[model samples]
Target: MITLSAFADEISPLPEEQIDVLARHGIKHIEFRSIHGKNVLDLTDDEHAQFRDLLRQNGFGLSAIGSPVGKIKITEPFEPHLDRYAIALKLAEFYSTPRIRIFSFYMPEGDDPAIHRNEVIRRMTALAGVAEAKGIRLFLENEKGIYGDTAERSHDLVTAVGSPALEHAFDPANYLEVGQDIDSAWNLLRPQVGHFHVKDYCTKTHKNVPAGQGEGQIPRLIADAVAHGYKGFCTLEPHLVVAEKFYGFTGPERFGDAATALKTELNARDVSFA
Candidate 1:
């Protein structure tokens, strides 16, 4: 069965607000990107423990740690970034979660991606290796402007690494924003997808929209995923209000709207989700 989760941080920087809105929508898990305006990776040990307690008390579980582990520029020094990645791994263990969402490193603006293909693979391979050693799965998201933003390159990077610990966290809105045909991207990358990010984007308006109200083809993707026996988290990441490079915010009401839009599409397809 498909399960529901979300970037609750989109609802509010306050943990209580995030949890409240999610609970109201029947979402019991969160993607755990940030809380209190700080990214998950930057949370202090005490902060992590406190949040863990709060989640447990509220009967919430973590679907994944929405980490920015691989969002840095490709040209940045790798050693320090690798050190930061270790923090993400620790967060996963802290939350008792096996999954973490990540990105392919961004290519320099105006540069040909082909020239950096080897480096991207090399970095991804390294990241995958660390996760594999810890028995954690890294879900690589196709963020706009990243090396694997397109299906073909995403496929290439994943295949080149060839690590079972690495898989796709398919984001239809992201692909749409990058000008990829959703159906075609899905056809190519579906087999590797281990998670889904439920959101939609309008290429024409260059804005984020509630699911099924934009060109991301949310309904078709959901129907297709169900038909293919896909069973995993459909994590809502609606950037309906403020879409930014490192994060986005939808506030409480808009987050609820996005949640309803996704549920509407799922109900139309008779898909079962928690």
Candidate 2:
């Protein structure tokens, strides 16, 4: 029963029309990226409350707060990031979402990866302490141009943090971006995975494609996670919203195309979205 969700950012800026689109597509859960076209830290209390009310009225639940917490240089001290995390936690409480997506940020130029690695673990652990007390889980997503881009590094960072509050948000296409085989990457990060991102990529061009149309081996990835007993949401972060220049279509058209492809794939594999 892996519930399918989508990022609000994919739909962009929380428009009323987007809610209608999501409702039409039967998308009941969303991981909010930002509120009122700003980061979570910048959202005021009134805006947060209004956002929550909108979701409630629209029959949507906030799957997680997609906070850009700590997605900066590792050399930068943790204090500034901590402030943002605190704000994110408050918003998470307001929205009644139990999870937040965080990052390992970029490694500083000409610095030892080892030092940056330790700093990330230390900072994440401190954040995890606060999150644990607040009853929230911080999920570290592997992204390109970041220290934890690969399965191995992300696993090591999670191991070093050693907090139950900290877990992995697995994204296969991200591994593909860094030139890792999706199957091997999944095997490496299987033990630490707490959530998932559903996306696909063109192996040669490194471009995003519809979920089942790329070289990501999505069926195998989903099967592996199911076999490993991953009982969490497989949220769709479809980067397929960019239209071809020649076609002059909008982002939603691309997203709708991707959604159709994903629905077909899931049907063929007997994976029910509900």
Candidate 3:
């Protein structure tokens, strides 16, 4: 229960290298973010073929399309991004996974996120409709500065959308970064969490860290999730090397460290997992 997966591209941009590193850690699943230094959404038809071949040859499975589908400026045009989301949906279908990780659009600097709520809801509802029609599920990640970044706003989006196709992808580190109360956040978001992300943030150093070693409250959350009969993929977004507002990086060694740290936390919770 509570199986583990990772954004393997953080290990290396090269798909083959990413696979090799994951295999060494006994990981069979990866959040398909990028391969060969290209974003997943940017991959061409030929590239998709090659990516599939590599995954098959290496005995790996995809957890979700780790797409930057809505990581755009909120004030920018929406039509183009909706088209991009269509591409992400196709990729998810092609990879045989209903899981697709996405974000609400980022708010313009110093803009009140609440002011954009109506627009965010409209766009999210549209995307949810597409997923429902196509038999896929969308996991909305709570990235900072986005309209749905906070736990309350995140719950609101899921509630307002009123669709099973759309739900939450819980990330404790992200919550902590915004000074949210984890207990309250968990209580509110728990019912809607479709997937979990593994990462930790150090308040003291203000940097990313391995799970269970910082302000993420990972162990407590894991125990609670399992106690509540929750079982699903906990996608690793280690951000070990170069975590920025938009992207992150980590090599094979650091990625392995990140995976091990998460495994350690799970083990302590007496949770059986890969």
Best by TM-score: 1
Q: Could you give candidate 3's per-residue lDDT for residues 88-132 as a string of tens digits? A: 988988888888999999999898888998999999999999999
The clash count for each model shown is 0, 0, 0
Which candidate leads the pack in lDDT? 1
**For candidate 2, lDDT tens digit of each residue in 112-159?**
567677677788789889998888998999887688988888889888
Would you list the C-alpha lDDT of every candidate in the order shown? 0.91, 0.77, 0.88
TM-score of each: 0.98, 0.92, 0.97
Give lDDT for model 3. 0.88
User: Where in model 1 is the C-alpha error above 4 Å?
Assistant: none
Please state every model's RMSD to the true fold in angstroms.
0.9, 3.3, 1.0
TM-score of 2: 0.92
lDDT of 1 by residue, 1-274 (tens): 7999999999999999889999999999999999999999988989999999999999999999999988999999888998889898988998999899988898999999999999889999999998999999999999888999999999999999999999999998889888899889999999999989998998889999999999988878877888999888999999999999877989999998999999998899898999
Error of 2 at 171 (Å): 1.3
